[model samples]
Target: DTTVKQNPRYKLARVGKPVNLICSQTMNHDTMYWYQKKPNQAPKLLLFYYDKILNREADTFEKFQSSRPNNSFCSLYIGSAGLEYSAMYLCASSRDGPETLYFGSGTRLTVL
Candidate 1:
């Protein structure tokens, strides 16, 4: 199959809590796309092939996947989204890092 896949295609996460997401490729495809979508909200861009694979579709395309004129972000904001809002904030990705790096009390994203 030429399909890119991520496990638990559908997930359940607490509104303000954390969730575990597992991704796998049956074909071991070259790339995988992780999309976070909310009810009635358009699919938001995540990242890209990340290995510098260029987009040949329109020639100058991106996101992770992007194209917007959305009216969802207000001054307070949600008149929609913008091309500038296409990434994960406070996210870290490491595969070959030191395992002894966790010596902290912890991390918590406080919303107030």
Candidate 2:
């Protein structure tokens, strides 16, 4: 099926430290999205990489940073970790269009 991949399924970071997450898709999908998921709330769309261009949701535009070095790789970078940063980070890739996304098991960031 889909080849989207995320690393370090579980991560623990200290307050004020930097956290970086990596994602790669062997499919070389046209768009890749990052989302933040908390317990009961809906998964929040954070940002996405469309080919080489990056688009972030306006409300979450400043909360996170991301980069796509090449078509197959994307990285999610958080400058300073906080308790509020603790959440499940989802990575997904879609081809043809953004309507259909194939997701990888999320990376859980726990700030302490």
Candidate that would win on TM-score:
2
State which candidate has the highest lDDT.
2
lDDT tens digits, residues 5-61, model 1?
233333333334333333332332333233444436654434323223422233223
Query: Model 1, 34: alpha-carbon shift in Å?
Result: 1.2
Q: Whole-model lDDT for model 2 versus the true structure?
A: 0.91
Which stretches of candidate 2 lie above 4 Å from their native place? none
lDDT of each: 0.28, 0.91
Instruction: Give me the runs in candidate 1 sitting further than 4 Å from their true place.
Output: 49-112
TM-score of 2: 0.95
Kindly list the per-residue Cα lDDT of model 2 for residues 1-112, writing each as its tens digit.
5767899899999999999999999886889999999999999999998888999999888879999989998999999999999999999999864367989899999999
Q: If candidate 1 were superposed on the true structure by all CA atoms, what would the RMSD be?
A: 15.6
Q: Worst 10-residue stretch by lDDT in candidate 2?
A: 95-104
